[model samples]
Target chain A: MKLTILGCYAATPRTFTNPTSQILDIKNRLFLIDCGEGTQVQLRKNKIRFSKINHIFISHLHGDHFFGLVGLVSTFTLLNRTTDLHIYGPKGIKEIIKLQLRLSNSRTNYGLFFHELESPESEIIFEDEKVLVKTIPLKHRVYTNGFLFQEKIGDRKLNLDAVQNYEIESCYYQKIKNGKDITLEDGRIIENDKLTFDPVPAKNYAFCSDTVYNEAMLPIIENVDILYHESTFLQSEGNLAKKTLHSTAKEAATIALKANAKQLILGHYSTRYESIELFKEEAETIFPEVLLADDGKSFEF
Target chain B: MKLTILGCYAATPRTFTNPTSQILDIKNRLFLIDCGEGTQVQLRKNKIRFSKINHIFISHLHGDHFFGLVGLVSTFTLLNRTTDLHIYGPKGIKEIIKLQLRLSNSRTNYGLFFHELESPESEIIFEDEKVLVKTIPLKHRVYTNGFLFQEKIGDRKLNLDAVQNYEIESCYYQKIKNGKDITLEDGRIIENDKLTFDPVPAKNYAFCSDTVYNEAMLPIIENVDILYHESTFLQSEGNLAKKTLHSTAKEAATIALKANAKQLILGHYSTRYESIELFKEEAETIFPEVLLADDGKSFEF
Candidate 1:
């Protein structure tokens, strides 16, 4: 899976800085997360096709997190998009979007679906044959949830020599690759494990943003391959974080460390901090495997 | 009065190209016109303060015309702006904005006023002592109107030579400048022209965009100092202009010529034409005083 950081700045969008927006390319789909303002322009700059974005996941109703969504949806209509669009966010998303479309006299030719997420527990919001996604309920001023996208383990590769000696039918060989043993034509029993190699390990990506320091999410996103969490402040501004219910860099790292994530990506920096170096330094104190998220940056795992 | 071109490109926004958005800096107030997508970014790049712009005028409901409005308004709230914000646009602007705010639960901290315009006839929408603005009804796919911003005639400047001869009270000097003859204490009648210089001719700006060739507005916008009209296509793409209800370069110049404006500023160009020489070439054929408008390029008249 490849994750493209379309925008990572925190709070308001500035000339040089952008707000939260990310694109995850997994299972042949581009999942947009938290479309801040200028997301369409960012997508254009990254040379990503607008139609590729089939699903959108918004963490909360914060302006910085989802202000770009309406414009994107409008542009989709302008471009005459026909594919269905799915959006998962807080309960009020549908009414808001419908109102704008109503006022503008704009009706989409494509099917638009909304899945209002109000569950406070870890629940699967989306699932397919290759991937499963669950929300990690977060603590914030408003209702918010982080997503844990997990790629399921695939079918194991077969040992050609074992399959040939077993003389199994080709159709039965397919079952063996799925970790199932089948009886041979000569009545010789062959175990699936000896004939097949282990399947590729599932890779997991956890996205947590616009939230306070909450260890409750660790149980759901525990030991993910990569974790992206909001770092809205530094330790020096810890009091401000508490007042706003936003997490500081140190707090984000603490959660990442406790979750035992392989790598931690810190983003959603406050507008007050001009440079992200302070965020990286603060996060590294507790979580040494910290990486600063930058707009237009990409990572692969 | 100064007109700053914040963004003047047509079609979709790119890193280097932007949609239509301009700032008219007249006296104490900053007025915004036609905010397309990425307008806030364009404003930031131009180093314009958000607080300074409390009044925004939108010509239509097209995505390329007012898509950036909601984001800019939201950004103001995020920045904790408490000043009153006013918007004047076509009907449905309030619903579009209110829906977004409702969905995100992002409401203004200060006063928010909306003056929706649904009248098909030209009318005075804004008036102050120093400025008077009216709509120039236009024909397009959607109900649309172009704005005409004009500076009202101001008080004349005193002629120091004439003032030395007359024992004029300083407070009454303003009345004399307003073209009223004032009698001096010594029983001498001072002609208004003798005591004061002629008031500076009122300056005016007319905006005509996204419209087909129509001469009906020529009389209303006649003798304006400067006129910025859309020239979306060159003579080569004039056929497209007819179907789209947009103007060609020649068509815009014809309107300028008929209006008898001091200067014609042509923009809203379709990106298909790589070179602007054709636009200038076509417009100058009819009106030699025509000027091509560029992105972030401003002109003074």
Candidate 2:
């Protein structure tokens, strides 16, 4: 899985930065995450294939988060897209998109589906053969959800040395890779573990933003392979973060540490801060595996 | 009054150019006309004062016409605007904005008023002491209205020669300028026209885009000071223009000439055209005063 940061600023679009928007590549599927205003332009700037996006997960309804959604949907219609698209967001998203479509008299040719989250409960909204997506109920000024993406268990890997040592027939290698115990022509039974290796552990990505530090979510996001938490302010501006229902670099790192995430990506910095080096330094004190998200930067997981 | 063209391309937001968005400065009012996807950046590039624009006039629901509106409004709120802002557009515009606000759970401290147009009739939507705005009924794919902004009739101007040579008293000059016959201190009665000239002919500016060449509007826009009409295609693409309910450059020029406008400003070029010089050249064949609408270029009326 790879993650692309299109924009990561908080309140409004700045001269040098953009509002919230990101694209994540998981299991060969493109998932647009938290689309904000100017998202299409960001997509173009980052060279992301716009039509390949099959699923969109919106964190909340803040103008900074989903205002670009209507325009994007409309652009899709204009571009004559026919692929099915799914949107997972809060309840009001349907009304917003529908109203714009109604006003414009636009009927999208593609099959557009909406899965709105109403309850603050952890519920899986999407599941395919390769991945599963669940919502992370968050505490915010409004009803908002963070998302967790977990890759499905992959196919087992065949152990060449072990298979040869066990004298397994070549025709039985496929069965062994499928984690099955197989019998050879000599009436010798080869155990699954001896003939095959365990599949790699599934990778997980958790996205949490526009929320205060809630230790309650630690269990939900625990052991995530990669975690992206919005650190809107620096540690010195902790009071401002509290006032705005945002998190500081230290708090984001604390969440990452408590969740046992292998790596933490901190972003959504307030426009007040000139440089992000201080944020990385502060977060490193609590979690050493920390990186800052910059616009157009891509992370492969 | 002055008009600045921010962008006019039809379909997509390009790296070198942009989609539909323009600025009209009338006296003290700065009106944003048809905001497309990258209007904020366009405004920044043009060095236009974003906050000074208190009113946005959207011609229709087409994404090419007004896709950037929500972003601009959100930027205003983030900028901590305290003045009331007004939006005029098609019927569904209010709900589109309100639903986004509801989802984000954000309410503005200042008033956000929407004057949604529903009836397909020409009517005055905005008026002040200096300017009067009336909608021009148009035929399009969706419910749309072109705007006609006319400067209000002002107090009569004092004929300098008559005021000085006729020895008119300063106190009586005011009455004569009001188009009333006045008596001088010498007991001589003077006709209103003899003492004062007519007030500056109310400058009228008609703006129309995203509409076909509907000659029905000639009466409303006849003999205007300036006319801005969409030139989405050249004559070679006339068939496409008809299919899309758009106008060619020659068609736009014909409408301008028929309306007896002083000058014709053409924009909203189709992406197929590499350069807009052909548009100007075609338009000038019918109306020699035609000018291409380049982004950031300003026209004084």
Candidate 3:
């Protein structure tokens, strides 16, 4: 899986800094997360194909998180997109986007679907044969939800040597790979474990942002291969972070450590901080594996 | 008058090209016209002060024309703006913006007002002591209106040499500048023309964009000091321009020539063209004094 950071800063978009937006590529599919203003331009700069984005997940209704969604939807119509597009966000998101489209008299040439979320519990929002996505309910000033993407384990691999030794027919390989025992015409049964090898482990990625230092989500994101958490402030601004319902670097690191996340990625930095390196310095004091996210940066795992 | 082209391209915004948006500084007041997506970043790149912009004029409800207004309004709140902001656009603009703000639960610290326009005929939309702005109704795919910015005629300038020669006291200088005849204590009357010189000729600028080659607005924009007209296509693609309800370079030049404009600025170019110089070449064949509007380029007249 690959994750591309289109924008990672907080608050207003500036000349050099952008608001929250990212692209996660897993199972050969692209999912856009939190499309902030100027996101289309950033998508162009990163050379990401616009048509590949089939699903978009918004964390909240803040302008910094989803203001660019309408522009992107309008641009898709101009580009003659014919594929269906799905959007998942808070309950009020549909009204915001539909109002703009209606006012502009713009009708999309493709099917547009909105799956508004108002639930406060963690539940699966998307699932397919290869992947599953669920929401991690978050605490914020407004209704918000973070998404968890998990890849399903593949079928066990066939051990050619073991199958040949057992004189298994090629037609019976399917059942062997499905962890079923093979039966011969002589009434002899061969164990499936002897004919197949273990499958590769599946990977899980959790995205959390715009939340405070709450441990309620720890159970949902425990042992995630990669965890992307918002660290909008530093340790020195802990009070301000609490007052604004945002998490500081130290608080994010503590959550990552308590959840036993394999690797922690820090993002959604407040523009008031001059250097993002300070966040790494603070996070490393608690969590040994920490990564900083910046605009146009990418990571592969 | 100084006009800054924040974005002059047509259609979707790209990494190197932007959509429709510009800043017109007339009579020491900044008037934002047609705020497309990514306008706030462009404003910062152009070094424009956010506080000075009290008024915004949108030509139409097209995404490329007014998609950036919501983000700009949200940014104003983050910046703690306390001044009133006025927006003049087509009918339904208020509903579009208010819906987004309501969904996000964001309220501006400053006053926000919208003046919706649905009239097909030309009329005055904004007027102050120093400037007057009127709508230049244009024919487009949607209900569109360009803007005409005119500097109101100022009081006569005081001729210091003449005033000193007449030994006029400073107390009567205000009356002299107001073009009033001076009456001395000895009952001598001096002509106003002899005591003051004519003020600099008030300049007028017309912004016409996203419209076809229609001549209905020629009377309103005649003798304009500077005219910025949209030339979305070259002569080779004039058929497409006609079908899209956009103006060709040659067609725009014809309008400028017929209107007797002093200088013609061409912008809102379609990205299909390889070079913008071809537009100037096509326009110069019909009219002289043609200038090309590029992103980040400024024009003074």
Candidate 4:
């Protein structure tokens, strides 16, 4: 899986910094998360194709989180896109998007689907043969959710030499890859483990932002390979973070530690800070494995 | 009067080029016109203070023309602005803006007013003692209007030597500046023209965009000091321009010529063109006094 940070700053987009938005490439699908204002320009600058974004997930209805949505949808129509697009967000997203399109007299040529999510419980929102996405309920001033993307386990790998030595027919190779023992022509039995090897472990990534540190998300995102959490404030601004329903660097690190995530990625830094290095430094004190998210930065795991 | 081009492209915003938006400074008021996406960043880049802008004029409901408005309004609230903001646009603008704010649960601290315009005739939309703003209706894909900003006639300049020669009292100087004949203490009457010169000629600026070559706008913007018109295509693409309800550079210059404008500024160029120099060259063919609008470029008239 590959992750690209299109924008990581908070509250407002600046000349050099952008608001919250990211792209996750997993299971041959590109998922957009929280498209803030100016996201299309950021997408263009990052050289990401507009057609590749099939699914968009908005964490909340805040302008800093989803104001760029309508613009992106309008641009898609302008480009004459025909592929069906799916949007998963909190309730009221459809009204906001439809109203703008209606006023502009722009009827989208593509099939636009909105899956309004209001459930506060952890439930699978999207699933396919290769991947599964679930929502992690979050604590915020408004209803918000964090998405957890998990790659499904693949079929076992066949050991060609072992299968040939066991006199297994080529047609039985499929059965062997499916972890089933094949009967020999002479009525001899062979164990399934002897014909195949275990497949590579599936990787998991969790995205959380615009929410305060909530232990309720631990069970939903437990033992994830990578966790991206918002660190909108420093440790010194803990009061401000609590008041605003945002998290501090230490608080995000504590959540990552409690969830036992392999690595923690910090983003959504408030613009009030002069530098983002302080966030990493503060997070490292609690969680040793931490990465700072920056605009245009990409990570492969 | 001074005009600053915050963004002047058409259709969409790019890395270096922006969509339609500009700032017109007249009579100590900064009026924002056609706020496209990413306009707030452009405003910041141009070093324009948000507090100075009290009025915003949206030409139409197109995404490229007014998508940045809500973000700007949200940012103003975040900055703790207390001044009232007035927005003038189409009839449906209030619904679009109010819905987004309601969904986000962001109640603005300042007073927010919307003036919806659906008229097809020229009428004054805004006026004070020093300035007056009228709408010049334009033909486009949707309901649209071009704004005409005119500085009201100012107080006549006092000719100090002429006033002293007439032995006019200092208290009567105010009356003379108001274009009234003054009676001296010795009962001698002095003509108003002799005591004071006529007020400076009222300067007028007309902003016309997203329109085709419609001669109906000539009377509304006639004899303006400066005229900014949309030139979305070149003369070679005149057919496309007409189909899109846009104008070519040649057509814009023709309007400037017919209206007898002092200067013509060409903007809203389509991104398909390789260079903007072609627009200036083509427009100058019909109108000798022509200026090209570029991002961050300012004009004084």
TM-score of chain A of each: 0.97, 0.94, 0.97, 0.97
lDDT of 1 by residue, A28-136 (tens): 8789998987888899888889999899999998777887787789878777899999999999888777866666567778899999999889899999989888898
Under CAPRI classification, how is model 2 graded?
medium
- Residue pairs that clash (backbone atoms under 3 angstroms), model 2: none
DockQ, structure candidate 2: 0.63
Each candidate: how many clashes? Answer: 0, 0, 0, 0
Model 4 lDDT tens row, A1-301: 9999999999988889999999999978999999999999999999999999999999999999999999999999989999999999999999999999999988899999999999999889899988999998899988999999999998899999998898777888888888898778898889899988999899999999989979999999999999999999998999999999999999999999999999999999998888999999999999999999999999999
For each candidate, give its TM-score against the true structure.
0.95, 0.93, 0.98, 0.97
Q: In candidate 4, residue A280 scores what lDDT?
A: 95
Best by TM-score: 3
What is the per-residue lDDT of model 1 for residues B1-301, given as tens digits with 9 covering 90 to 100? 7777876777566667778899888766789998887788888877888889988999888777887888888878877989999899998899888877776656888789999999989999999999888999998877889999988888998887787777676898778778899887878787888888877888899988878998988878999889999999987787889998899999999999899988898888887887877898999999989887877776665
lDDT of 3 by residue, A52-82 (tens): 9999999999899998899999999999999
- Candidate 3 stretches with Cα past 4 Å from truth are A164-170
Q: Give Cα distance to truth, residue B100, candidate 2, Å.
A: 2.1
Per-residue alpha-carbon lDDT of candidate 2 for residues A162-230, written as tens digits (9 for 90 to 100):
888776678887777778988777888778987777898899999998788788789999999999999
Model 2: residue B55 alpha-carbon error in angstroms? 2.3
Choose 2 or 3, whichever is better by TM-score.
Answer: 3
